[model samples]
Target: MPEYRRSLDIYQGYNYKKDKQTPVGYLTKIKVAGTDLTVDQTCKDPTNPTTDLKCVAVLSGALWETGVTDAVYLSGQVSAPNRQTLASLIINSLTSVEVVYQFAVYDYDPVAKKYYLAFHANQTDMNGLLEKRGEDLNVSVADDASTEVQSPINYSFQIGIKPQPSAQTLHIATADQKNVVKSWGLALG
Candidate 1:
């Protein structure tokens, strides 16, 4: 089977006033506003030069706010017509496939002092029979200032496809530095 590489882009935004008093034991809730999926067919499989192979790409992921809300998930799959063909090609050659996902995060309790953002993704064969593969991306947030903020945090996941699909690394960053306070990947696994 060909190898595949998958990546993700998670955009997070919120409106919260730092000075606003938060109720005791308040929890921030991050919801999935919407999502978009894209696949780029870079090159042909080196092993088999005869058939023009295409990747069977599917995007599935979730957003989790630590100590706050339950996970909110989403999945995007390729159309039925392309599913079989792409799945066959991916199983034959070690082809690398790039899938990009765009999603938005809306913070429910923006006044919370601190919270952690956790993003996860799962990839499977077209039939959804293969072993489930996943990736996890995390970021830490703390806001001390008393200001309402709206920002986006982008997360990228590079996945290496093998007998068992595994995430190579996760990249997380935000443009709004004032509200972020701090952010980083918890671990690469």
Candidate 2:
């Protein structure tokens, strides 16, 4: 539902603090509330809006990422009741839902204290949804498997997200910082 252009300006935000280690490129590591989020983080939507998407608050959420090739795993802590909220949705034909996700990738350097947006996962073009898997459906494929996701204590649900091809990648012009942060629901640290 959004248009595309070849020109892109990866945002260089005001964040320059090196308080903690942030894994650069592909965003392999992510944390919420000091807890190590276990899922691989990536662009939730292909459009990858420069502006932020609406964000909903969950008390404790263990988000999922079942990806291939450049695997982006996103795992977090979800309270039992919160987990139930997602459970009912993966019923009937609707296998999953994009609850609260807006992909904003960055090429960050902690030491240098600089970062830029690589892509945005807009709500309209997102490719994955959060899903709960039963033991029967949780078997490994080929020799490739996710040991972290297989453990019950680690996570109770799963979601797979695949990156869009480079040829298909598109960008939209971004708003100024206030509007961008507001629309993006980005929490300033």
Top-TM-score structure, candidate number: 2
Query: What is the model-wide C-alpha lDDT for candidate 2?
Result: 0.28
lDDT of 2 by residue, 1-189 (tens): 232122211111111123432322122222221223333212222123243322111111122221221222332323233244434433334433333233343333444444444334432333322332542222111222223333222223333333333212222223212112112121235
For model 2, state the Cα shift of residue 62 in Å: 13
Q: For residue 140, give model 2's deviation from the true position in Å.
A: 15
For model 1, the stretches where C-alpha displacement exceeds 4 angstroms are 1-60, 63-78, 97-107, 110-189
Off by over 4 Å in 2: 1-18, 24-73, 77-82, 91-101, 105-107, 110-112, 122-124, 128-157, 162-189
Best by lDDT: 2
- TM-score, prediction 2: 0.32
* RMSD, every candidate, angstroms: 18.5, 14.1
lDDT for each residue of candidate 1 in 1-189, tens digit (9 for 90 to 100): 211122221111111233432211111111111112223222222122233323322222332232111122332233333333333433454222322323222122334334222222212121101112453222111222112211212122222211223222322222212233122112236
Count: clashes, candidate 2 = 16
TM value for model 1: 0.22
